[model samples]
Target: MKSSFFSILQRIGHAFMLPIALLPVAGLLLGIGASFTNATTIDSYGLQPLLGDGTILHALLTVMKSAGSVVFSNLPILFAVGVAMGMANKEKQVAAIAGAVGFFAMHATISAMLELNGLLAPDALPEGSLGMSVGINSLQMGVFGGVLVGLGVAALHNRFYRIELPTTFSFFGGTRFVPIITALSYMFIGILMFYIWPSLQEGIMHLGALVNRTGYAGTFIYGFIERALIPFGLHHVFYIPFWQTALGGSEIIDGISVSGAQNIFFAELASPNTQQFSVEATRFMAGKFPFYLFGIPGAALAIYHCARPEQRKLVLGLLLSATLTAVLTGITEPIEFSFLFAAPVLYVLHCVLAGLSFMLCHLFDVGVGQTFSGSLIDFILFGVLQGNPKTHWINAILIGIPLFPVYYFSFRFLILRFNFKTPGREDEGQETKLYTRQDVNAAKAQAQKGDQVSNLIVAGLGGSSNISHVDCCATRLRITVINENLVDDEMLKSSGARGVIRRGTGIQVIYGPHVTLIKSNLDDCLHNAV
Candidate 1:
């Protein structure tokens, strides 16, 4: 049962990746376009007309603005689609239909509430009132709404996908039933949001104002708290306050101002009266440039170099992939997780560096914002979009250069100093190699003949009763045991586990990508043993 639950969680994580991948691209385009607008307006002298009346330049500017608007305006739709796709079982078509249905339902519900409120208030209704727009209409759509839609769709899909219908209603059976059920489910969701969303929004805005009052200290706190909450996927809650509130602008809630990195940056770019303040204050986000564009890759290189001589080739390939991902999209998980659990000290160092980078950028007044992390893509976009693009961000690339080597060498020295068990630095005789095809076939044949390798593994790991959790992802079997001491190293080795690693309160068994299949087999063995 524990194994089954873990398997489900793994699938959910995999599904989420579908939407997460597209975010970086959206972020890149939005950042670039925003930067272009800022650059053209702030440094119009550098932007000359290519032809009469500067039609080409005007067209280019229009396209950039359109791209920015699309991304910002349709964020809710993106979230809905992303959630639906991530939560589906087999047919993504069902998920897609459900997403669209949910979007419309929420919007319609909100609009209805607005009309109802106006009718009830009559004379109290404000003049020139426009009805509320619903669904994932803007960045205001919120992650909570996306998750609600995804959950509703997944539940409907799983419950009704195979249900037999009355003959009269047979036309809507199976896949066709998905959209109907999804639409009905969202009706309640919409009604709920209509009444609840306003309070939630107000609360978030209030929180933003309180944080903004902390100023630079507040920014540092936000950065620290954001990184801390990443493991549980709750960082979005912490982020929305700054991104959506007025603290960073002239907007006020309960007579208090709200200012966050994104809010401040946008205000600086868009508000004519406050353009100068925006240029200087936007630097709160600039410090991340070095960390994203150079520091991370440098760390990856360091890890590759510190790998054992025999393992260098394999580790190099892994780090190279991770490095490119970090540089392009600012998704650092693949690289960060590589050593985070194995060598926690290094992870702490990374967090510290990240905080410092944000602080230094703020101090230097180099401000930029991207949908993702502080990568080269955002750097260019933010710099180009600045009110005083040349004055504030000229030194970004220069900062990144020295920071790269500092990250690389520092990571290398730390790994060596601590003899950390990162990747290839495992203790002697600890290396696990993939079995040859012949060897695997031989094991399977022997198993049929009643060889007890499978049984032995179950017993050695304290049987089914001792297993608290069992999960697999890509290349490893993530397990939690009732008692860590019950896992015998030699017994697991003989049963074909390539390697074993223990961290605080958890253990990992390496079996490469095939670990999932092995995990299923192991589950069966443990269950039968019980």
Candidate 2:
């Protein structure tokens, strides 16, 4: 079967997620480091005596924060490895080597090309330049460079992982050829980028300036587009540029500059404060805190309240869990999808209100950040722990409080008034069963320690014999089975699945953010199958 454009994009999005999982700890460490290092924070709070300079506490805290700092500092490499790992079907570690090689070569070659052309400099390079240690040497392609190298390496891995070569050069065939080709291929890419990037950086800088100049309006537009595009899984397209490129990235933090919004925030947090935290630098992010931490969950309450009293129990478990997930981790698909199909108008309204939240937060000058999503986890790690008297992070709550009512009254009234068929309101003809405690225990036992979840999921889908192929993109595990009758939907749900969809002999097992792990586990299950 031919894949569609949507499928290709979904796969790329999944690839993007491979490295995103590293942000939370980085956020936490950076927050703590920033809070302590700020002479004002300690002096104002009167912790000056204990956390003063030359104390072990201060030194230890600095070390802890540096642990997280290095991850973002080397993010270009992370992206290359992540994209390679995500795209490769097998021999992932080998592909990663190719990615690393390609990335280094691309950046180094670009640097050399620039030096030759006199278009670049070691001292006065552009702000988006990748490496300089504040001066500039090489490897300045940033996230865009990382992506190019990753894609290049992955394409080679997938196409030539099993290619044959003449007997004399057989040693260079298969996995061995990957890194060699990656290095050679990126030279051309580097040459192209050498000429293109200066102009590209200018364009990106202008775009970033445009958004920055718009201030609150730009934030609202970003929030609106982000939420609006969620249903199509294109929200990544809306945010990635802002998050990764010079557009919304490239802020100085703690003395060391960084790229990407979240990384910049963490980096900024750990750096010594010369001035009050800059809201302008963090404008792309601060608004999401309110929407994710409070506003969206308030919408969940509105949904539950509007659910039919009789069927409410059936959905309460799912809704509550979904709400908690949104509050804690900032994953909202379960809750969003609950009403997205039934009341799409409400989704539009949600996006608009979310936009309003962003605009309001910006106007108040409240700023905070998170690595992955907007959640209370972010609230605590990036907001509360990284507290500054000057930062209006607490204002997130004030804006968030109104949203609950806004979402509740609006959704409740609309659902009742227009008869939106959200959740419990669905016709009795649609049969639904929430995963039960008994089902949970069964799946848990079946999914053993090493490959427990993987094996149980395999069993649910009728095991190795029944499954002919397996692949995943983002939230769902896409599988091909020989017989549909052997697949058990309840079993899959019991195996910690969010949901299941079947089309012919193809099945999709929804697993939310951990789908990558599940896909790996499933692969392991097949490798160890009985």
Candidate 3:
């Protein structure tokens, strides 16, 4: 069951990645359109265009804006299709159709409820009157709604795809049943949303307002909590306030507002309303630029320098990729996960740095927002379109360069001082020795002797029965065992694992990138043993 859950999560990640990868294209289009508009305004002010305003430029701007608008408007549809396809095993087309059906069903259902509520007089209606407004469209159509649609579609597709039908209704058998089931399911979902979505939305807005009222301290808490909640996939809950509602968002339409840290920041950039506290509240995010773009990379450099002589090159390669990701996209998972399961103290340090960065940015009033986190892409765009256009964002980069080195040296010194077994710092006996062909042959000969090394590993961990779940990512066998303490580290090491890690009630065995294959082998071993 644990493995299956992880598998679902992996599929969801893949689904989300597809649409997310396409976002840069949307950004480029929007940027170009904004640039064109700027150029046109400048020309109107009697400035001669180096590249004259021809039909070509005008046409290109129109196309880019149109494309961007389409992408922005249909994000929910894109999400549904992406998620369904990612989750489906073989019949992607069936899943896609189911996704579409599910989306429209929820949309129609929500629209109907709002319309119905509008018909009833206030005195005759329930308190809050369902807070349902017709033609109410949310930014990105709500991630939760998209996920529900995808799950609904996938479930229907999987369950009804092979169901036999009466001869008269045979046409609706198999994949065809998906859309029918999806439409029906959404009616119930719509009714639930009518009663629930308003309160949830208001609650989120209240939370955002509360955070805003806390000022710099609130921003610090938000940043720290966001990082800490990552392991449980609950970061989204905290992020919703900054991204979805009016409290932390901007008034885009006539009466509607959009909130989220990014939303608020962008709203401030697009239209600065100094009177509104929400717009001014975005200063909290500005301080994060230096830390994400520089400090994390600096920490990576420290890890590389502190690595054993033989492992320095390997560590450098890993840190390089991780650093590049942090700088370009603000995706710090690859870097964070490196020491997160090893030297937890460093992870805590990262959390501290993150909080401090936000506080400093808020103090300096240097603000920018990104779709992801504080990465180079968001940094550049936000800098160019800043509310405080006179502020020197370049200074943030200048400050970051030396800061990176400081982080590196300090981390190296601390790790050495504490004798922490971070990555390559393990004792000689615990070190992983790579095997050549000759060594493989020697090990094979030893295995031929009455030495069941694999069985010993299983036994040391309280046998196959003890393993409640097993999955993996790039470098570790993520396992949920009956008792984390039952797993002997020495036995796992003898079986060729690089290391063992524990978090809460979970245990992870390091097997590098090949951990996936190891997880499969272990699963087979367990099943056969049972």
Candidate 4:
């Protein structure tokens, strides 16, 4: 029962990656556009001639900002479609269409309920009780509304997509029945929500208030658990609520009530009335800057310096590339996985430091925001470019600089004193590099001719016969197998995977950010082979 529940959670997390992947680009557009277009920022920098209202640059930025803001504004529908499609096993496009129809149906139904109850006006209901969903006057269920629709529709889709019916009604059977059923289900859900969601909203708001009351200690725990879940690939599931729902906190910006940490930060970014970014919202985010941008690189450097004298030359290029990736892109899995499996104690220490980073950043009131990860690009666009007075981005820098050496000296001491087998410190001929060149080359050579990676992955997972289901998340190919004993971890690693993770019948093959592409190709490969 526990494993089943865990497996479902893993699938949901994987499903979320589809929509989560879109955030970075949307944030990029919003951050860059909003920063340069802000009147105060323009005047402070004395760039009125270049970026002032009505100027060509200013007009283009306005368009960019709108384009980005639209994504956040319509996130519920996006999550609805993305999550439904992601969770579906087959006929995914059908699920996506159903998700959209259900979202509209649900909101429209709620709008009708409001009209019947004489609660259509904002003043007719309590403050923040009435809001819009895709222009439909309805309860402010936020992303939760979308998720509710998505999960429900996906379940309906999986159950009905291949269902058979009487010959007279066969036209509505199979994929055609999914959207039909979804619309009806969500219409009922909408009626239920109209009656129940106000109370629920109050509860969520109070919960958000309670979390805010926890202050710095709560922030520390948030950061600690976020990093700790990396090994299990469940960090997304852990962090999304705080980032997207009322659990993180809520605030009013430009007379608009914004719930969730990231929403508040971005809303403030877009509001011309903003004097400064909200520390309450950003405290959930700014902590990532220090650890991801500076501290992880420090740990990478430590691993390099501690390498065996003979292996130092070989490990330099690898560590350098990993460190650069972490510093610039905030993709730390490569560097993280090295010590994660080698010296778990070091990873624990890193998590503790990470918690402290959040608490300290909160204490200092650094109000940096992130599109997705704590990358240099996001740091500059959202933090540094937004100006020091507004974001207090310099405090993050001051705090982050010290973390570099702290991670360096501490990791160096721990590595040497404990003789941890991190990277180059591995026993001779025992997988020293993150991945072997020979295995990567073999996978590439086969791919040049055909779907070699997919074939190899199938073989590595004990052939197609052993597989029961397949899915993927941001960095891993998630699969469930019938026979765990048939799985070969070494073979999986040989197929360009960074590592193989096993939990009962569940298998996750780590492939970094490109796992989506691999998944698409593997899906095609499986279809063709079938």
User: Each candidate: RMSD to true structure?
Assistant: 8.0, 4.5, 7.3, 1.9
lDDT string for model 1 (457-485, tens) is 66667776777666554445656677777
Of models 1 and 4, which has the larger lDDT? Answer: 4
What would the per-residue lDDT of candidate 3 be over residues 1-530, giving only the tens digit for each residue?
56445445544544565444555677556545544444433365543444245656666776775675455445556667667765665577888888877887787777776667663443453232222222443222354566677766777777777878999999998888777888899878877876787677667557656766888887777678767755443354455435433445334432334334544443333332322223234554565688888888788877777778997775666677667867886766667766765677877877777776666666555545555457787777656433234334665666567668767877888788877666566678754232223333543454565335446557757778887656554445656667666778888877766556555346666544344445555666676788
Q: Find the number of clashing residue pairs for candidate 4.
A: 0
lDDT of each: 0.59, 0.74, 0.60, 0.86
TM-score per candidate, in order?
Answer: 0.66, 0.84, 0.70, 0.96
Cα lDDT of model 4 overall? Answer: 0.86
**Model 2, 1-530: lDDT tens per residue?**
32334444555666787777776777677667767867877887888778988888889878877887877777778889889877787898999889988887877787787678675654566554646422336645567777777888898998888888999999999899888888898888888887787788778778888888887888889889888877655577578777777777576665445666655666567666545456765667777877786777777777777778887887788677777877887878767767766788989998999889878877887767668778787777667765655557788888888777888788888898899888777787854332334444544455565667786788899878998767775456867677879999988977677567665576777766556667876787798774
Candidate 2, which segments miss by more than 4 Å at Cα? Answer: 1-3, 118-130, 133-136, 249-258, 429-475, 478-530
Stretches of candidate 3 exceeding 4 Å from the true structure:
1-18, 39-55, 84-92, 117-141, 229-241, 244-250, 253-256, 263-288, 308-318, 384-406, 429-530
Top candidate (TM-score): 4
The stretch of ten residues in a row with the least summed lDDT in candidate 3 is 125-134
Q: lDDT value for candidate 1?
A: 0.59
lDDT of 4 by residue, 1-530 (tens): 55556667778888888888888999998998999999888989999999998899999999999999988888889889989998898889999999999999999999999999889865888776666788898888888888889899999999999999999999999999998998888889999999899889889888878878899998899899999998887888888888887777877777777778888899999998888899998988999999988899899889999999988887887888777878787888878988987899999999999999999999999999997789899999989899898889899888889999999999999999999999889897775676334444554566677977898899898888888789987568989888889999988887778788887677889876567667887877877868
lDDT at 373, model 1: 63
lDDT score at residue 490, model 4, on the 0-100 scale: 86
Q: Which of the predicted structures, 1 or 2, would earn the higher TM-score when compared with the native?
A: 2
- Worst lDDT 10-window in candidate 2: 431-440
